[model samples]
Target: MSSPHPRLSARQPRYMIVAQALMHDIETGRHGVGSLLPTEAELGQQFNVSRHTVREAIRRLTDLGLVSAQAGVGTRVRAQRPVNHYALTAEGLSDLFRYAHEVALRIDSQEEIVADGALAAFLECPPGQKWLRLQGERFVRNEGESIGLAEIHVAASYRAALEDTNRPDAAIYALIERRFGVEVREVRQEISALALTAAQAKRLGVAPGSPGLRLVRKYYSSSGELFEVASNIHPADRFSYASTLRLRPTGESEN
Candidate 1:
């Protein structure tokens, strides 16, 4: 049995009612970074209000940087950017990675390694090809939460670029583009079910073997050449991906 969600009474102004509920969600981190917010239709259905009322509520939230809308993408939770689009992206990766490093997220190791299996497939080179591996760990910034571990596998050729501090920034791909003239134009990631290792659990502040999001990402260059591959372990309850998709009228007729 579960308790009901808190809601303003029907007697109150509809916009105020919806706005309050949405604010509560933001304050509680229920709609944190990468959280795709419910659609106007969904909110209207949930609040038993008209779409116009829902729109006004959304507008208020948007003004607060708690929500954002794209032309084709309806609305997504603004990523870590306290202003807007907070989540880390290709363009923002350098800054976020630099911030993480500045905030004492340590880089454990950087070395050369030969990868086989799926990692090989993602890097798209012959098995045992030399790759530059970067292993780093992130903490909660203030609290010692030990967020998780990060591992990036880049071509050996990128090592020099990453080591160049004079470059734009330290994010591996960002450095590759600015220093080595390599541009990552696209990326694909895969998430697999996994039990956390003791080290991961300890770092994530979770029990050993706890379910986590094991992410594998393949980044490609502007020439459509595969450039880097990365594997990350994120606490399941703490990590998520959100995308906003606009809904077009199904009954509409096109010229």
Candidate 2:
């Protein structure tokens, strides 16, 4: 007989684990909207983690608009769902590709440059590599508020692909596939929170140093070659990421 144990990957940070648990409870009605969550110390004890970890988890919930925290007043559930209603909801990893059609990118400038220093590190490329950098803002169709500021970089060899496209608002990967036959078969994405720079804040119509969600995505071709890298910054109040998950049945091995 096969063992019931499932293969697992590296563990996530404690804060993330705690945050996901709280999110589950909130979603399942254990913690209803307008209800106050347990104290950080109590949560820490219940989860067997430090109060700092619990605090960080609560911070994540606050960022998602699910809860609000105030000094001496305890954390309160603000909503069951995230505040932003994006034109496109990335319910799964593959759903990101559909963003080009759902939320159009309005290209502001296209330039060729040699990457070095911070830019090279950000793209995971060596210094002095040639790149075609496209800077733009993403907006929901028929909406007035700009949702995100994006900086996308494609290898210099692919510059012609973007230049040939009549629809500057289309996704970079789609443009490359149409013109150069390069297919993006896989995507690696990272999400984090940081204070927005002055330029990004101005573009998103938020004050400087306001909290923002930073998304870094790397696109890989079918041959396992990295083809494109993009960094997008969205105001915390303006964008939210979500996905649906289901539990596995007994005796089922993960795919």
Candidate 3:
């Protein structure tokens, strides 16, 4: 006898498959905005999955800002597309990809520069290194308000990747990987408190001297070569960072 449920592909997680199907439904207006989704039991029955599986799928939707759940009310469609925000709760590199998808950078200027002493220290590179510098403002896709000022410095070798920086949908490192046939094996990030400079404040529409956060990320190749450095300065009210911590299981040793 054939199985009662539809065949699920082993290539992707079961919950993810269910989530993608539901997201498509939401986007197509099958489940219109503000409409409550079917209850767990109903969804489970329709998908021929357990209630736990349905709940997990719903949780994925919630993370993308597509729906919300309350104790008494059922899950409601919040938006057709993922909501853009500077707030990030990053667990790993994958989370960074999600963030990149939610926001876009609008380049305002570009130049080729040889790193001076101060620039070299900031980029974590030796002095006199040639780089293609791109400056821009970051925003929620299609929205007007700028959230941060961004400076992206790419090693001169991969300057060709700049061809697609205008493609609002592409990530810089991904562009480098595709154009240069290199892999970004690691990303080092540093965050610090700062006061917005007058120019930065003007660009971000924030007041000078306002408290802010400076985020710097260095992308490295599998062979330990640094390929790019990106720095973003965000107004205190516009951006937030969150992290999760978990305790190790018994008998697990720290690396």
Candidate 4:
């Protein structure tokens, strides 16, 4: 086995620290692709942790596409570096807000525009309405690679709400609410499949014509007024959205 890694700080979870150390070993080639990692018991002994902790660490590696584990077979290093796979499990509006907090947006450009016929149709607003459009890439917090490109349009009245776009801690809609006291009562979302254009592929670091997903969300206020429209494009390989559906009890009426 390789030399034991130095002790990690207690600030983070134990499994995460163990996972980080193992990931470092893989990236440094100490654990080559196709080679089996140290057994759970061995890892536990080396890290002075429980076998359960070691297992959880390996699970984290598996989630990142770095390693694979099979019954009766040791975990094998699948890749030298972590794959940038982002999965969002949205069950409610709060979950959507949580997703926004998990990803940081880096705005590339901004402009004030009057919605033309086509743009107005997309935004579900009347033609000639003014909007503040912001374009950006969304990254997993503290990671370098971007997972998606985002285009957001805010009603020109709330343009001032975005004055602190640099703040990654709050969602844009939340900012609008805090600034203008307009509550977002509903969010309508649509997902569509598309082949990425060359320009989009260049910005997203994917091949032209790659399969992708476009997600558009329309935010509405309590009075049934649309205030914001946001769209995000994600490479098929990098992002997945999941939702849970529960079956109603028997005899439950559709109405």
* Clash statistics: count for each candidate: 5, 0, 0, 0
**Candidate 1 residue pairs that clash:** 79-86, 79-87, 80-86, 80-87, 81-86
Clashing pairs in 4: none
Among all candidates shown, the one with the greatest lDDT: 4
Single out the weakest 10-residue window by summed lDDT for candidate 2: 1-10
* lDDT value, candidate 3, whole model: 0.81
lDDT for each residue of candidate 4 in 1-255, tens digit (9 for 90 to 100): 444346667788888889989987998899999999989988998888898999899989988878989999989997788879889998888887776789888888889999988899988888999999999998999899989999999999998888755544678888889889999898898889999999999998766998999988899999999998889999876788898878889999966
Of the candidates numbered 2 and 4, which has the greater lDDT value? 4
lDDT of 3 by residue, 110-229 (tens): 899999888888777899989999998888777877778889999998888787456445778888888888898888888999998898778765568978999888888999998888
Arranged by TM-score, best first: 4, 3, 2, 1
Q: Rate the local accuracy (lDDT) of all candidates.
A: 0.66, 0.80, 0.81, 0.87
Give the poorly placed runs of model 4, Cα more than 4 Å off: 1-80, 250-255
RMSD of each: 11.6, 13.1, 10.6, 6.5
- State the displacement of the C-alpha of residue 198, model 4, in Å, after optimal TM-score superposition: 1.1
TM-score of 1: 0.53
TM-score of each: 0.53, 0.63, 0.64, 0.69
Candidate of highest TM-score? 4
Off by over 4 Å in 2: 1-91, 164-169, 247-255
